[model samples]
Target: MDLKAGWDGTWQEFLQVDKTVFINELISFHSSLDWTLELEPAQRFAWETEYDLMKSMLGHVVRESNTNPETCWVAFEQELIGEGGKRAADVNLVLPTGDLFVVEFKHKTEASEHEILRANSDLQTMLRYHSESIGLVGHGYLVLTKPGAKEFKHSGVVCEIADKGQAPLLTNQLITSLRQTGSYDVLRWSKGEFYRQPSILHGTAQVFFDTKIPTLKTSASENIEEARDALLKLYQHAKAKLKRYVVVVHGRPGAGKTLLGISTVASVARNDSVKQSEPIFLSGNAPLVQVLQHTLDFYGKRKGKDVLGRAIDGRVMIEDLHIFKKHIKSSFGSRKETFVVFDEAQRAWDKASPRDSQSPSELMLFCNWLSSQSFGVLVLLVGDGQAIHRNEMQLEQMLADLDNSVRAQNGNIVAIMPSLHAKNMRLIKPIKRDVFNLKTPIRQSYTEHLDKWIEAVLSNNSALARDVALSIESDYPLRVTQSKSLAERYSVELQNTLHEGNRKPDAFRSGWLMSSHGGQFIEEVQKDKFKPGKRIGPWYVEPPSSDNSCCRFDAACTEFSCQGLELSLALFNWGSDLLFRDGQLVLAEDNRHRRQYDHYTEGSYRVLLSRGRSGLVIKCDDSETFEYLKNCGMRVV
Candidate 1:
C-alpha cells in the first residue's frame, strides 16, 4: 500500500515541528497512511536521461505491497481547516478503511501523567464522536515530537499495539518506512498483563483520549474583565507580600461571576510569579463543579503557540470545596498552591453545617493559616442572592453585622465565617467595590429585564414589574399554567427549538425548576415528582438523550440544587414554599417542615425566576398566586 492523497498545507500548518519524523512515526503505527507529504527518499530517484533506456528495461518497478492499496482522507470546513479536532490535537486522520484516528503531538520526550491524561481526554472525545457519527472504528494515536536524531521513547502503551494479544497495528508501507529509520524492537510494544487493563481513555485503542476539556474564553465582558484584572492584582499582592488576600467578585444572579472565577484561575496558572505551583478551583456547588470539571479535565490540552490565548489548560485542580478538605486536611497549611478560586463562596457552609464537611469560612481561615506556611490568596466568587439552605441562612442571620465579625487572634486573621467569624455579605474587605463587583445582570442573560421584573414582583411593585415584564415578554417568555402536562409539553417545544434538529442532545438544557423542600403538598400540588438531593447534578448535566436528563421531563431541580446552575428553558413549578398573602409574597403557612424565613422564600423565587437562560415558564396551578402573577402581566397560556 502507498500514501497517494496529497499531504497538502493542512498538515503543514497543523504540525509545526518536523513533519517527516511525525509522518514516519504515524505511518509505522498503521499499515498505510492515507496522506503523502512527499515522495519517499528512495522513491524520489529516477533514471538519468543518458538513454538510460537500458536501466528502465532492466529496473522494473515491483509491486509495493501484497495488500491492495486504498485511500484515506479527512473532511475540512471553510479554509479546509480540520473539522473533528481540537487545536491541541495535531490531526483527525481518516484512514483508507474509513476509520478515524485522532493524533495528539506531544513535545514530551517521556510523557508526564498530566500530559497522558490530557491527550487521552481530547482523543477520547473526538474518537467517540467519530465512531458515533460514522459507525466506524476510531482510535487515538500519540506522536512524541522529540528533537534532533533522538528516538522518542514511551515506557507505557503505544498505539502500535492496539490491544492485548493483538498483532502490531503497523501497515506494510509504514513498516518498510520505519525499518529504514530504526529497528522493529524500537517501536514494538509488549502486551503484558499490566497493559491489559486499559484506561478509560483507551476503552478500545491503547492510546490517549478521555476528558472533554472546553476551550477557555479570552474575550470577556467589560465587567468580568475588570473583576479579573482586580483579581490578578490581588493574586500578585498575596504572592509577594506573603499574606492572605481575599477579593470577592460579586454580581447579579447571572452576570458571569463564575466566568470571572474561571478567568482568574487561568490567569493565575499563567502568572510567572507562581511558576512553581498552579492554582486550584474549589466550589461548594456540586453541579457547578461537575460542569466545570467536565469542561476542564485534570490537565487540559497543552498547546504551544498553535493555540489561541483562549485555550487555557491546567484547570485540573478543580474539586468540590468539601472534597478538597477531605483529601488534604492534614497538609492544608503546607499545601504548595498559593492561590485558589472558590465558586459560590457565599453559599459555603458554616460551623452550623454538618460536622463532616468544612465550611467556606473555615477554608478561608485555612487560607489565612497557609499565609505563613506557604502563601495564601483566596478569590471568592459570590453572587447577589440570599442563602439557599437553613444552615447557611441561619448563619447569615446570626452574623447579621458581619462587618464586626472578624477578630484577629495571635496575629492570625480569624475570619469567623460560620465555623469562623464570617464577614457580612461574604465580603472580606481590601476590595474596590467597583473593580471587584459584577453589577450588570447576566443571568436570564437573554433578557436584561428578567431580574428587574422578578425583583419588582417579589417586592410587590406591580407597576414597575408590569412594565419590565412587558419589555422582556417577547424574548424571555414568562408563561403560567395550571397543568403540569402542558408545562412539560411547552418545555419540550422550547428545548426542541433550541436544538433545531438532531444537532446534539441537550443543545440547550431545559427542565423543571421547583421548590426543593416540600412534602405531600408538593407531591399532590406540583403533580410532578422531582429527583431531589444528589440526583440533581446529573439532571442538569445529562443530555435529553439520556433518560436521566432533566429534559426528559421526568426529573426536576429545586432552588437548593440549582442555585448556581441553570437551564436554557426553565419550566418552574411555583411550589408551596411561598404564598400570596396581604398583597405580598410570604413564606408558606405549611404544617410540615417546609417553614422558611421571608428572605429565604423570596430568594428561592429569585433563584428560580432567573434560572432560565432563554426564558421562564411558571407552573402555578394555585389560583391565588396565579391571579396575582397574571395581573402582573405574566404571559398566560
Candidate 2:
C-alpha cells in the first residue's frame, strides 16, 4: 500500500521516520517479559508505557502472524486529523483483507466515561480513513490493560487481558482470529458518523480561495491588482518607519477585505523581512480558520511542503484571536510577531463588555501590547458592521478619539474602502483621514448592485432596497415565500441545481438557514424531524443530515455555522427574530429564541441572505412580514 498517498501531507514526513529499531525494541521488551506488569493492581501504568505496550503487541502480531500479505501493516501513534480536532490511535493494525482495526489502550482498571467517548470518536475517524484509503470500513477496539481488570460492555464491549501469561501473544491471537473470521464489528456501537464533508468555495469565498500559488482566483482583474499593489505600498511604508501602523480595511460583506488581508500576508512571506518577524493572519471565527487552514494545507501538500510544520515555524500563521492573545501574553516584554492581519476586528469587545468583565477588552489589550513593542509593528484591522452580541465593542467604539497618544507614537490608521463615498457607508469620517477603496465586489456573483440591495434590505430601508432590487442583475434565482412547503421544494430544486446532476459521492453542499431559537417550530413545520440523537454544532461542522420516511433533509445550518463558509443555495427560514412592519424592520420582543442583540439583528440577516451565490429562497412565516416584502415588489412566490 502506498501509505504516502493515503496519508495527509502533514504526516508524510513523519511516516518516513525509521521504526524498525522501535519494532525490534518492542519485540525484545515483550519477549523478555521484563515489563512492570507485577506492580500493584491499583497502580496504573504510565501513559507512554501503555501506548508502547499496545504498539509492541501490534508489531508482535505482524512479526508472528501468517496472515494474508495485504493486511500485514502496523502503525504506532498514528495521528489522524478529524474535523473536530486531532485524534491519534495508540495502535493501528491493517489486515490483508483490506480491514483496519484501531485499538485504544487504557492503563487504568476502569476507563472513565470521557476516555470511552474519546475512543469512540477515534473509532469514527479510523472508519472514515479506512473507507477513503482502502475502499472499506473498519472497527475499533478498547483494551483495558490493568491487572485483573473486568470486561465491561456499552456500545462496544471492553476487553480485559491484563497479567495473563503471555498476554500480548494471546491478544494478538484473538485479534488475528477475529480478522480471519470477519467477526469483529466494534463500529456498530457508534453507527459510523463522519463529521467532515467535501466543501466547495463560491462567490467571495471562492474568489479568496482562488487567489495567486497561495491564491487560486482565475481572474487577475484590475481591482485585485490595484489592491495588491496598494497593500505592497503600505507594507513598504510600514517597514521604513520606526513607528507602529494601524490600517483599517472596511468594505461591504463581499468586498474582499479578508482576501486582501490574507493575500498581503502571504505576499509578505515571499520576501524576507528585516525585523525577522513573520506575518500572522488572525480571526475570532474558528470556522474561517479551519477552512483556510485546510485549503492551504491541501495546496501545500501538492508542493511537498509541510504546512503544519510551517505553521509551527511561524512562516505564515493562521490562528484564532484567542490563541493570538495567548501568544501575546506568553511573549512578555518582547514581540515575536511584527505584522498581524486581524479579521473581523469590529467583533472585539470593550472593557465594559460582559465577556471582558474580568479582563481588559481584547482591542484595548491588543493596542496596548502593540504600543509596547520594541520594534515597528503593523496591524491591519479589517472588519465591517455593528456588534452581533450585546457586549461586543463595535469598531466605532474602539476607534473613538483616534487622535491620541497612540497615534502620536508613529501610529497610522487608514480606512480602505471601494470608494470615498461608498454605498455600504460604515466608515468613520473624522478618524478615517487616509482612505483606499476597492471598487469591485469580488464575492458578488452578478452585478455589485446586488450587494447594495442587500445593504438596503438589511438596513430596513425598504424603499431603497426595492429600488436597488429592481435594478439588480442576479446570476442565480431569488424567491421570497410564505409557504414553508414551497420553500422546502425550492430548496430541493436549488440543491439539485448546485449538484448539476453530478452523481459523485459529494459534489456540493446545500441546506436551510434555520434560526437556532425555534427548534420546536421548525420540527413541526419541516417534513423531516431533526435527528433524535444529534445536537447542533457551531459553524465549522455540518449538522447531522436527517432522513424522513420519504426523503432526506439536511439539518438546518445556522448563521454562526455558515458565517465564513459559502453554499450553492440557501433556503432561509426567516424566523420571528426580525420582523417587518410599516416598511421598517422590528425585533420580536416576545420571541423566546432571540439570542443575538438588536444591533446585530440586521447584520445577521444580511450574512444569511448573502451566503448563497447561486440562489436564495426566503421562507417567512409571518403574514405581515410576507405582505411587507410583497408590497416592496420582491419576487415573492
Candidate 3:
C-alpha cells in the first residue's frame, strides 16, 4: 500500500528529517495479529466493558513476533511505578528482534514535563523487562501519538532516560495490555502540501507535487525569503550567461546574509535547477564555520545521512575559505563546484607571495580559469565596515584583482555589489544593487536606525549620532556603566529574559565581548577564553548549564574571535585600544595596535557595538571614556 503524500519523499530526502519511519511497520504489525476471542464468561465481562474489540487485537499484535505467543498475550500485567503513582503506557511494542518502541497515546494537545518523564520511565521499565527476557541491550523510542503542539521530547533534554548500553531503570516489566493516547508525529511530518490518508471506502492517493524544502532560517523573516529569491535569480542569470561572476551580498551585521547564502544553496541542492554542481559554502570565520558544519552534520545524523561526511558529489560541503583555497590550488585541473559561498569575504587574507597566488586574488583567478572549462559564480557574503584585519582585502581590491585576472585571460567578468558600496566604486548600478543587498534591520527589535547611529558615532559626528540614538534608544537600549560587575548583571538579566521566551533555551545565546588588547593580563587566571589554543566552538554551541557556554559570561571573546557572531544581549568590556580622544575616535597611546590604520580600529568597535540583538551594556573602566561615551548619546546604567 502506497500511503505516502506528496512531501513524504521530500521529508525522507532532506538531510535534517526526523527518524519516524514506522507507519508501514505498524500496518504490517496489525496484519500479523489474529482476532480470535475464546474468552470465558468472567473474562468477557471485564474485557467487553470498555475494550471488547481491543482484547483480541491487542493480544494478537503483541504476541505475533513471539515464538511462545501465549507469553505475549497477557493484559494489564505490568505497571510503571512513578513518584506520584503507578502508570502504564497505552501501547508498548516489545520485540526481542524489533526495536523497543513504546507508543504512549496522549489525547491531550500538550505533553507536560512530568508526563514526558512518566512516559520515559514506563518505556524504560517495559524495555528492561522485555529486553532482559529477549537478552538484547538497545535504545528505543517513546512515540507519543497526539496531534499536539507541546513537545518536551524534541527539546534534546530527556529528563529520566538511561544511557545506551546500560541496563534500563525499571519498576515492573511483566507483559501488559496496551492503551492509546496519540500525537501523530508521523502524520504531521508527512502532511506537507497534501494529505495522505487511507479511506475506508477508497484506497490511498499517490499523485502530487514534491514538498518544497524551505530556506534555512536563523530566524523567521520574510525579508530573508525575498533576499533568497533574488540571490537564486542572480545565480540563475550567471548560470545562463556561463560567465565568471563576483557578486557581493552585503548587509549590516545580523541582516541575514549568511542565512540567505545557505538557504540559496539548500534551494539549489534540492532542485538542481540553479546549480551545475553541489555548491560549496566557505567561510574565513573559524567559529562560524565550525558552528555551521557541526550543526548541519549533527542534524544530518538524525536522518542517517552523512550530509558532510564526504562533502563531495551530492553532499553539502562547508569548509574554511583558506582550506578551500588549498583544494583549488592542489586540484588544478580537477572539476570543482561552480557555485561557491565565501562568508566574511572582505577578511580574505592578502597575497602571501610576490605573485599574489595565495589570496582571494587566486579565487578570482580560479574563476577566470573556470570560465574556460566550466562557468563559476563566487557569491561573497560581506558586511558594511566589517574589515578589521590589516591584511584583509576590501571591495575595491577584490574588484581590481577580479578585473586584472579576467583581463589577463581576456575573459568576461560580471561583478555585482550592494548599492551601499557604490559610493566607493563607480561600477555598482542602482538597478543591479537591490537584487544583491539585504537592508532589513534584524539585530534587535525596533532597531531600524541602530546602524545609522553606530555609523554616525564612528564617523565622529556627535550631533548626528545623538539625534540618531534618540530614535532607537527606547527600543534597542545601549547602556554604559563604569562598573564591570554591573554590566555583567545587566547582560545576564537580558540573557535570562530572552532565554525564558524559548522552550529550548539553548538555542538563544548571550555573551561578553572584549577587545584583544590587554586580554593577556586576564588570561593568566586560566578561565580565559582569549588564551592561545582555546577554541570557541564549545563556547558558542554549548548550553548555558555547561561551563563552556558563552552565556556563563566567564570567558569573554575579543572582536576578532566574534566578528560574525551575534548575541541575545551583549556585555562588552571596553578595552583601552579604541576610545575617544580630543573629540575623535582613536586607539589609546599604549595600545599594542595603536600604530594600525584608523579605520581598522573603528571597524572593530562597529562589530562589537552591533553584536547584541536585544540590547548592549558596555563596561567602560576608564572614567573619562565612560563619561565621553555617556555624553555621546549612550544611555547610562
Q: Which prediction has the highest TM-score against the true structure?
A: 3
Better of 1 and 3 by TM-score: 3
Model 3, span 105-150: residue lDDT tens: 3334455533453444444444332213122222333322234334
Model 3 per-residue lDDT at 479 = 85
In candidate 2, what are the lDDT values of residues 376-415, reduced to their tens digit? 4444444466345555566556554222324333444333
Q: Rank the candidates by TM-score, best first.
A: 3, 1, 2
Candidate 3 stretches greater than 4 Å from native: 1-227, 230-244, 273-276, 298-316, 349-360, 412-433, 444-448, 459-464, 498-503, 518-534, 581-584, 591-595
RMSD of each: 19.4, 19.5, 17.5
Give a tens-digit lDDT track for model 1, residues 1-637. Answer: 0112223222223233244543443334222322223333432211011012211211221133221222323221101111111122434444333344554443334544334433444443343222122333455545443332123333222433212211133233232332232221200111101101111111111111221112112122555666667667766766687656554555556566665666566556555534454677787766566655543332233212211234433235566776665545555544566677777666655542366465344534444345445456666666546576655633343334223233332333323122223334454433235566566653323346776788788888878888887766534567888888887777766544322212333235777777765433232112122533335434555556766567777656776667766666788888776777778766666655254555677777788887776567788866888988887778776
In candidate 3, position 373 carries an lDDT of 51
C-alpha TM-scores of all predictions = 0.55, 0.53, 0.58
Whole-model Cα lDDT of every candidate shown, in order? 0.48, 0.51, 0.51
